[model samples]
Every structure is written in C-alpha cells, then in structure tokens.
Target: MLILVTNDDGVRSPGLRALALSLGEIGRVVVVAPDRNRSAIGHALTLDHPLRAEEIKPDVFAVDGTPTDCVNLGIHGLLSQRPDLVVSGINCGLNVGDDISYSGTVCAALEATLMGLPAFAISLDTSLFSHADLSVSTRFAKKLAVDIMEKGLPEETFLNINVPFGPCSGVELTTQGKRNYGESVVVKEDPRGRKYYWIGGTENGFEDLPGSDCNAVHRGYISVTPLRTNMTNDKTYAVMQQRSFACMGDID
Candidate 1:
C-alpha cells in the first residue's frame, strides 16, 4: 500500500518525521509537506503564484506551499501511483473545536476527501514549542491508518484525530466542539513608531459540549471526529424549503 504523508509543520518537524517513520512500517510512505510551517492556513490553494517542490531526500518532497498544495502535488504530480490513504500530521498541537476550520492540518485531509480519497489528520494536544516524544501518537496513527484502509471512511467524510499528551485513557468518537473566542488581535508599536498587529489570542477554552473532540481530549482520551466535505446544513435546507419567498418575484 502506498501512503501519502504530509503536514502543516515544515518537512523537518519531529512530529512529521515520527509519523512518516512509523507509517513506513505498514506501507510505502511518501512525504510531501510544506518547506516551512503553515499552520492555521486552512484549505488555501496557491493559485496566485506558481508552486515549487524539491525532493530533499528519497521519498520526501518539500513544497513551497500550504498543506493542501502538498496533498494535491503528492497525489497528482509526485507519486507514480495513487496512494491508498492520505494522513496529515502527527501535528505538534491540537486541532479541536472551531480551530479545524482554520487548521491547515485538518484542511489537508479535507482536500484529500474532496479528491475522493480516504484521509485523516492526527494532532497531539500539546504545546507547539514542547519537545514531547511523539511515539504514542505515531503508533496510534499507524494503527488508525490501517483501520481506515480496511474499513474505509464514510463517503465524502474524513477524520480529525487529537491525541492527548502522555498515556491516553482511551479513544472516543466525537463531534466538532465549540470554542469561546475572545478578542484575538494584539496591537503594538514597532521601533519606527508604526503600529503592528498580531493575530493569535490567548487560549480562551471551549464550550462544555459533551461527546465533542475538545471534551474528549480534555478527559485524556484520543478524540476522533468524523468530518464531512459537504458543508450544507440539512436542517436549514429543510426549513427553507417550507418557507415560500414570494417576495423574490418582485425583484427588478
């Protein structure tokens, strides 16, 4: 089996290396990842500028683009054969709650799902600057990859896996949780007296939503949330169908 491995963390990331090495024991692994950290980039495609990929080592390619671009290039341009699975991360930090919408790690898996491939993004619920050993997360990722390949993901659906630091209590299937985001922008003055702004915010915590990824991770369990590429709200669609907008006929 050919497995395509990629991450939002740069190609040299310890998490990425650990993931690729662990999964290599199961199948042929090809790594195509961003040359630099592109965290929280979402599902952005580099259409405005040309992308460049360099094979820094055998079976490893570093692309000067987002995690989504790496997946695209891996499946279409780099590998000779289609991969059986696409696994993003073993990311340094967690991608739970509303953060998945802004996560390049999760978006990489989403891109693969859009291309009709089985995929999952795995993250470690730890600080990005921490040098925690990734053996546990990598092992679980390998196991999960095998399971995904054997069982097959639901149609148009991928997964978001967040493994807590240290020993895990167990694994739990969860839903996307909600985050309580406060003012995230930080204003500052540069040495030149010009104002500059930073985007990230202090962690404000999550909603008390049980059976959610955030909750599961907080309880020392690996959180596995099945995510779908289809963004349509079925309940809203059903409600809109019953409401007749006869006023629309008055448009000039």
Candidate 2:
C-alpha cells in the first residue's frame, strides 16, 4: 500500500520524521509537506497564488503552501501511484476540540478525504525539546494507519488522533473534545508603531466529557476521533427547515 505522510510542523519536524520512519516499516511511505510551519491554517487552499512543489529527496517533496496543498499535490501530481491512505502529523502539539478547527494538521487529512481516500491526522501533545519518548506515539500511529488500510474509514471521514504528554496506556475511540481558552491571544506591537497579536503563553482548559478526545488524552491514552468534512449540524436541520424568514425576492 502507498501511504502519503505530511504535517503542519513543516517537512523537517522531528515528529513528522519519526512518523514516516515508523510507517515505512509497513508499506511505501511518501512524504510531501509544507516548506515551513503552517500550523492553524485550517482547511484553506492556495487558490489565489500559484503553489510550488520541489523534490527535496526520494519520495519526499516540499510545497510552498499549506498542509492541504501538500496532500492535494501528493495524490494528484507527485506520487508515482495513487495512495491507499494519506496520514498527517505526529504533530508537535495536540489538535483537539476547537484547535482542530484551526489546525493545518487536520486540514491535510481533510484534503485526502475530499479526494476519496482514507485519511488520518495524528498529534503528540508536547514540545520537541521536551524529553517525550515518541516511540509509543509513532508506533500507535502506524498501527492505526494499518488498521485503516485494512478496515477502511467511512465515507468523507478522517481520523484525528491526539496523544497525551506521557506514556500511553491504550487507545480510545472518542468524540471531539471541548477546549475553553482562557484569555487565548496576546497583543503585541510589531515595528513601525503597528500592533500585532500572538497566540501564545496560555493553555486551553478542558474537561473529561465521557468518550471525548480530551478525556482520553488526559488519562494518558491515545484519542482517535473521526472527523467529517462537512460542518453542518444534523440535529438542528429539521428545526431550521421549520423556521421562515420573510425577506426574499422583494425590493421595496
């Protein structure tokens, strides 16, 4: 099977390298990732500007675009054959709850799913400089990837896997968790009297909602949450159909 690997932390990130090495033991691994870190870019694509893909090594390419662009290019243009699955990350930090909404890691997997392939986005909840042993995390990610290739993911669904900051006990299938960011952004001034902002210095608080990704990871387990490309709330659709706004078709 052909497996395409990528990450939001750039092509040279240790986590992405570790994941690629681990999955290489299973099948053909192709790595196409961003030339630089593109974290929190969500599911955006580079439609306005021309995307560039450069071959950095054998089966490894770097793209001057977002994570989504990497997967789209890999499957459509770069890879020698169509990949059976596309896997993103072993990212440097966790992507859960609201973070997934803004994560380029998840967006890479979303791109693969849109292209009709089973996909996964995996993350480790720690900084690279920390003494976090990535062996277990990468191994688990490989195992999950293998399982996905064997069992196959549902239509339009991609797995978002998040590992906690310690040794793992086991893995859990979970729902997207809730993250409450307490004073999330920091306001700073760039050069030339211009005010800028940075999203740093604070952590998002979470709770153990049963069967949630946050709870599983908090308990030192790997959290595997299946995500969909569509953001529609199915439960509220019927209610929305019943309500009517009367401001259409008449210009008075």
Candidate 3:
C-alpha cells in the first residue's frame, strides 16, 4: 500500500516528520507539505498566484501554497502512483470543535477524501510548543493507518484523530467538542501605529454536553471522531420543509 502524508505546520515540523517515519514502516510513504507554516488556513486553494513546488528529497516535496495544494499536487502531479490513503498532521496543537473549520491540517485530509481516497487528520493537544517525543502518537497513527488500509472507510467519510498530551490509555470514539472560545481574538496596535490582531484565549472547560472531543481530551483520553463530507442537517431539513412561506390565498 502507498500512503501520502502532508501537514499544515510545514515540511520541517517535527510532528510531520514523526508521522512520516512511522507510516514509512507500513508502506511506501511520501511527504508533501507547505514550505512554511499554514495553520488555521482552512480549505483554501491557491488560484490567483502561481504555486511553486520544490523537491527537497526523494518522495518529499514542499509547496509554496496551502495544505490543500500539497495534497492536490501530490495525487495529481508528484506521486508516480496514486496513493491508497492520505494522512495529514500530528499537528502541534489540538483541532477540536469549530477548530476543524479553520484547520489546514484537516483540510489536507479532506482534499484527499474528495479525490476518492481514505483520509485522516491527526493532532496533539498541547498548550506550549515544546519538544516532545511523538513515539506514542506516531504508533497510534500507524495503527490507525493500517486499520484503514485493511478495513477501508465508508464512502465520503474521513477520520479526525486528536491525541491528548502525555501517555494515552486507549482510544475513545468521540464527537466534535463544544468550544466556548470567549474573547478569542484580540485587536492591538503595533509600534508603528499599525493595527494588528492576535488570536488567543483559553478553552472553556465547562460544557453540559458530554462525550465531546474536547471533554475527552480534558479528561486525558485520545479522541477519534468520524466526520462525514455531507453537511446537510437531515432532521432540520425535514422540519423546515413543512413550514411554508407561500400564501394559500392572496388578494389580486
């Protein structure tokens, strides 16, 4: 089996390297990632500017674009053979709740799913960016990758795995966490009298909703959430269809 790997934290990210190294043991692994950190970039594609990709080593390339670009380019242009699975991240920080919407890490994996391949996005939950041995997370990622390789995924579905910091006891199938990101964005002025913004805040630990990814992590457990490509709220759609805006009798 062939596996394609990419991340939003750029080619040099330790998490990216750890994931690639572990995946290499199971199958042919190729790494294609952005040249610079593209965190929270979402699923953006480079259209206006010309995207440049430089091959840094055998089976490893870096693109001057988003995480989505790297994955798209990997399957379409770089890889000599189409990959059976696409795995993204081992992201430095957590991507739970609404974080998935703005995560380039998840976007790379999602792009691969769009191209008809099983995909996964993995992240490590940590507050500080420090050197941590990723052996445990890498091992877990490899196991999951092999599982997908053996079992295969359902149509139009992808997996989002978030590993908690420190030793993990086991995996818990989870749902997207509820995040109360209070006053998250901070507006500021620079020394040159320029307006700037910093995205910063502590995650609210309080949520009545249990069995969420964030809650799981808060309790020190690895969270594995299955995500579907279809965003339609079937229950809500059914209810909305019954309510009509058209008038039955109107004066002409």
Candidate 4:
C-alpha cells in the first residue's frame, strides 16, 4: 500500500522522520512537508502566492507551504500513484481539545480525509520540542494504520490520536473537549522598541470532562477521537427552517 506521510513540524523533524520510517515497514512511504515549522497554521491553503516544492531525496519532498498545502499538492501532483492512506504527524506537541481547530498537524490529516483517504493525526504530549524518540507512538500509529488499511474507516471520519509522555495506561475512544486558556496572547517590546505579541498560553481547564480527549491525555491514556467532515448544526438548521424568514411568494 502507498502511504503519504506529512506533518506541520517540518520535513527534518525527528518525529516526522521516525514516523515515515516506521510506516515504511508496512507500506511504501512518501514524505512531503513544509521546509520550516508551520505549527498551528490550521488548514490554510496557499492561493495568494505561487507554491514551491523541492525533492530533497527520493520519495521525500519539502514544500514552502503549510501542512494542508503539502497534502493537497502531494496527492494531486507529487505522488505517481494515489496513496491508500495519509498519516499526518507524530507532531511535537499534543493536539487535544479545542487545539485541533488551530493545529496544522491535524489539518494535514483532514486534507487527506477530504480527498477520500483514511487519515490520522498523531501527537506526543510533551512540552519539550526536542523530545523526539517517539518509538512507542510510531508503533501505535503503524498498528492503527494497518488496521485502517484492512478495515477502512467510517465515511468522512478521521482519527485524532494523542500519546501521553512516558508509560501510557491504554487507549480510549473519546470526544473532543472544550479548552479554556488564560493569558494566551502576550505583548512585549522588542530590542527595536517595537511591540511584538506572542501567541501562546497555558491550559486553564478541561473541567475533567468524562470521555474527552483532553481528559484521557491528562490521565495518561492514549486518546483516540474520531472526527468527521460535516460541521452542520442540525438543531439550528431545524429551528431556522421552522422560523421561515424567507418570503415564499416573492417577485410578484
């Protein structure tokens, strides 16, 4: 099976390399990623400017774009054959709770899922960026990938997996959780006396929500949250239909 591998942590990130190599044991692996770190870029696509891609090695390419661009380009242009699966990340940090909305890592997987391929986003729950020996996580990813290759996933569904640092208790199926942040954006003056803002914050709380991805990670369990493409609010849609604001017999 052909497997497309990409990440937001950049091409040279050890997590990305390790994941690619681990997946190679099971299938043909191709790596296409950003040349530099593109963390928290979400699902941004490059349309304002021309995108650039370079083949640094066989089956490995670096693109001057976000993770979403990598997946979009890799599938539509780079790969000679369509990939059976797309495994994004093994990212440097966890993408739990509301963080998924801002995560380029998860966005890469989502891009693949949009193209009708089974995809998964894996992240290590560590604060340190240098922590790269993610053998355990890679193994877990390989196993899950194998299962997906055989059984396939539900339509429009992708898996978000977060691996806790150190010994993991086990895996748990979970739902997305709400994450509250405090002092996230900080303003500081640079050496040039210009004000610069840093966008980051510490996790405030998850309310210890049961069966939530954040709660599982906090409890040292590997959180597997199934995500889908549809974002429709059925209840709101029904309410709006009942309200009937539109004039049915207009244009007399």
Candidate 5:
C-alpha cells in the first residue's frame, strides 16, 4: 500500500514527521508538504503564481504553496504511483467546529476527496510547543488508514479527526460544531505611527452542542467528523423549489 502524507504545519513540523514515521510502518509514505507553515489557508490553489517543489530528500518534497497544493502535487506530480490514501496532518492544533471551513489541514483532505481519493485530516488539540506525546494520534491514524483501505470511505466523503491534548478516552463520530467568534481584528500602531491590523481572534470558546466535534474533544475523546465536498443544502433547495419564479419575457 502507498500513502500520501501532508500537512499545513510545513515540512519540518514534528507532528508531520511523527505522522510520516508512524504511517511508514504500514505502507510506503511520501510526504509532500508546504515549505513553511500555511495554517488556516483553506482550499486555496496557487494559480496566480507558479508553484515550486523541491525534493529535500527521498520520498519527501516541500512545496512553496498551501496544503491543498501539496496534495495536488503529491498525487498528480511527485509520486511514482497513485496513493491508496491521503492523510493530512497530525496537525499542530485542532480543526473543529466552524474553524474547519478555514482550516488548511481539513481542506487538504477536502482537495483529495474532490479528486476522488479516500482521505482524512487528523489534528492534535494542543499548542505547537506543548510537547504532547503523539503516539495515540499516530496509532489511531494508522488504524483509521487500515479501516479506510479495507472498508472504503463513502462516495465524495472524507473525515476530519481531532485528538485531544492528553489522555484519550475513546473515539466519537461527531458533527461539525459552532464557534463563538468575537472581536477578531486587532488595531495597532506601527513604528511610523501608521495603524496596522492583526487578523487573529482570541479563543472565545464554542457552542455547547452535544454530539459535536468540539464537545467530543473537550471530553478527551478523539472526534471524527465525516465531511462532504458538496455544500448544497438539501432542505434549502427543497424550500426554494416551492417558490416558483415564472420568468416574464423582459424586465421593465
């Protein structure tokens, strides 16, 4: 079996290394990741500028692009053969709730799903320098990879896995949760007295929704949320179908 491993935390990330090493025990692992951290970049493709990939070492390539770009290049460009699975992360932090929409880690898996591949993004719910033992997450990743290869993911669906910081109780299949976003922009003055703004928000917690990814992680359980590439709201589509728009020949 061949596995493509990538992450938004860049090529040198310990989490990335740990993930690659752990999965290597199961199959041939090729790592194609961003040269620098590209967290929260979402599913952005570098079409405006040319992308560059450097083979830093055997089976490892670093691209000067987003996580999605790495997945694209890994599957279509770098590898000798198509990978059986694409696993993004063992990320530096958690990607849960509404934040998954803005997560490069999750989006990497999304990109693979778009290309008709089985994929999953796994994240550790901890700070970058927390020195958390990643054995649990890596072990689960390998197990999940085996399960995926055996059972196969549903058509057009991928998973987002978030492992808690410390001891893990078990695993929970969850839905995307809601976040309490607040006061995101921070205003500041530069050395020249010119105002500058920072775009990060203080962590404002999440909605107390049961059976949610955030809730599962909060209880020290690994959260696995299945995501689909199609964003169409079936209920909304049904509602809109009831409201008929008979087009008059011409608008005055």
Candidate 6:
C-alpha cells in the first residue's frame, strides 16, 4: 500500500517525521507537508498565488502552502502511483472539541476525503511535544492505520483521533466534543506601543457530555471520532424537509 503522509505542523516537525516513519512500517511512505507550520489554517487552499512543493529529501516534499495543498499535490500530481490511504498529523497539540474547525491537521484529512480517499488525522494532547511524546502518539496511529487498511472506513468519513498526553488505557469510538470558546483572543501592545490582537488562547471547559471525544481523552483513552467531509445535519435536514421555508427560494 502507498500512504501519503502530511501535516499542518510543517515538514521538519518531529511529530510529522515520526508519523511518516511509523506509517512507513506499514507501507510505502511519501511525506508532503508544509515547509512552515500552517496550524489552524482549516481547509484553506492557495488560490491567488502559485504553490511550490520542493523535494527536501528522498520521498519527502515541503509545500509552500497549507496542509490541504500538500495532500492535493501528493495524490494528484506528485506521486507516480495512487496512494491507498492518506494520513495527517500526530500533531503537536490537541485537535479535539471545537478546535477541529480551525485545525489544518484535520483539514488535511478532510482534503483527502474530498478527493475520494480514506483518511485520518491524529493528534496528541500534550504540552510536551518532545520526541517521547511523539513516540507514544505514533503507536496509536499505527494501530488505527492497520485497522483502516483492513476494515476500511465508510464513504465521506474520516477518523479524527486524539491521544492523551501520557499512557492511554484504551481507545474509544466517539462523537465530536463541544467546548465553550472562552478567552480565545488576547490584546496586547507592540514595542512601538501599538495595539495588536492575538487570535487564540486556552479553551475554557468541555461540555459534560458522555461519549464525546473530549470525555474519552479526559478519561485517558484515545478518542477516535469519525468526521465527515460534509457538514450537513442529517436530523435537521429531515425536519426541515417537512416544513416549507420561504427562504428556500426567491422572496415573493
């Protein structure tokens, strides 16, 4: 099997390299990732400017764009053979809860799923992004990869797995968790006494809900949440279908 590995954390990230090497044990590995950290870029693509992908090493390419770009280039243009699966991350930080909407790590997997490939995103929840942290996380990644190669995921879905900072007891099938976005932005002064805004800070708290990814991770279990490329709310869609909304068409 050919595995195309990419990440939002950049080409030189220890986590990215670790994941590539771990996946390498399973299949042929090709690493195409951002030349610099493109964290929290979401599913953005470079449209106005030409994207560049440089071969930094054997089977390793550094893209001058987002994680989404790396995956698109890796499968569509870079590789001679089609990749059987796409995997992103072993990211430096946790991409659980509401973080997924802003995570380029998750977006890379989304991009591959959009391109009709089986994909998964892995993240390790920790402050210590050391090689040892990666060692623990990549083990979970390898296990998931083996199961994916054997069982296969459903169409339009990709796994978003988040492993705890230390040893996890086990793994769980979970739903995306929710967390209140509090103190996400900070305002500060520059050297010139000018105001500058920082976009994000620590999240406050996770909802007290069961079977959520956050809960599983909090309980020292790896959280495997299957996310879909489409954001449609199937239950809401059915309910809306029964009601005729004037907004559905031109206003009379």
* Deviating ranges (above 4 Å) for candidate 6: 247-252
Q: Which of candidates 1 and 2 reaches a greater lDDT? A: 1
All candidates: CA RMSD in angstroms?
1.2, 1.8, 2.6, 2.3, 1.4, 1.7
The digit string of per-residue lDDT tens for model 5 on 1-252 reads 999999999999999999999999999999999999999899999999989999999999999999999999998888878899999998988899988989999999999999999999999988863579999999999999999999999999999999999898999999999988788788999999999988864665899999999999999999999999999999999999988677754567
Each model's TM-score? 0.97, 0.93, 0.93, 0.93, 0.96, 0.94
**Residue by residue across 1-252, what tens digits does model 3's lDDT show?**
899999999999989998999999999999999999999999999999888889899888999999999998999988889999999998999898888999999988899988899999999986544656677789999999989988999999999988888877777899997777788888889999999987865444436468888888777788999988888999999998999857855746
Determine which window of 10 residues in candidate 2 has minimal summed lDDT: 243-252
* Deviation of model 5 at 82, angstroms: 0.8
Q: After superposition, how far is residue 78 of candidate 4 from its true place, in Å?
A: 0.9
Query: Taking the tens digit of each residue's C-alpha lDDT, what string does model 6 give over 1-252?
Result: 999999998999888888998988989999999999899899999889988889988999999999998998898789998899999997888888898999999999999999889999999886557634677678778888889889999999999999887777888999989987788889999999999988766556788789999899999998999999889999999998899777768856
Per-candidate Cα lDDT values, in order, are: 0.93, 0.89, 0.89, 0.91, 0.93, 0.89
Q: Using TM-score as the measure, name the better of candidate 1 and candidate 2.
A: 1
Tell me the TM-score of model 3.
Answer: 0.93
lDDT of 2: 0.89
lDDT string for model 1 (167-192, tens) is: 79999999999987788888999999
State how far residue 218 of model 2 sits from its true place (Å).
Answer: 0.8
lDDT tens digits by residue: candidate 2, 1-252: 889999999999889899999999999999999999998899889999888898899988999999998988898889878999898988888998888989999989998998899999999888772577888888888888878888998898999999888778888999998998888789987788899888855867886589999989999899889899888998899788887756655657
Model 3 stretches with alpha carbons more than 4 Å out? 127-129, 192-194, 201-208, 245-252
Q: In candidate 1, where is summed lDDT lowest over 10 consecutive residues?
A: 125-134
Model 3: clashing residue pairs?
none
lDDT at 29 for candidate 2?
93
Model 2 misses residue 250 by how many Å?
4.1
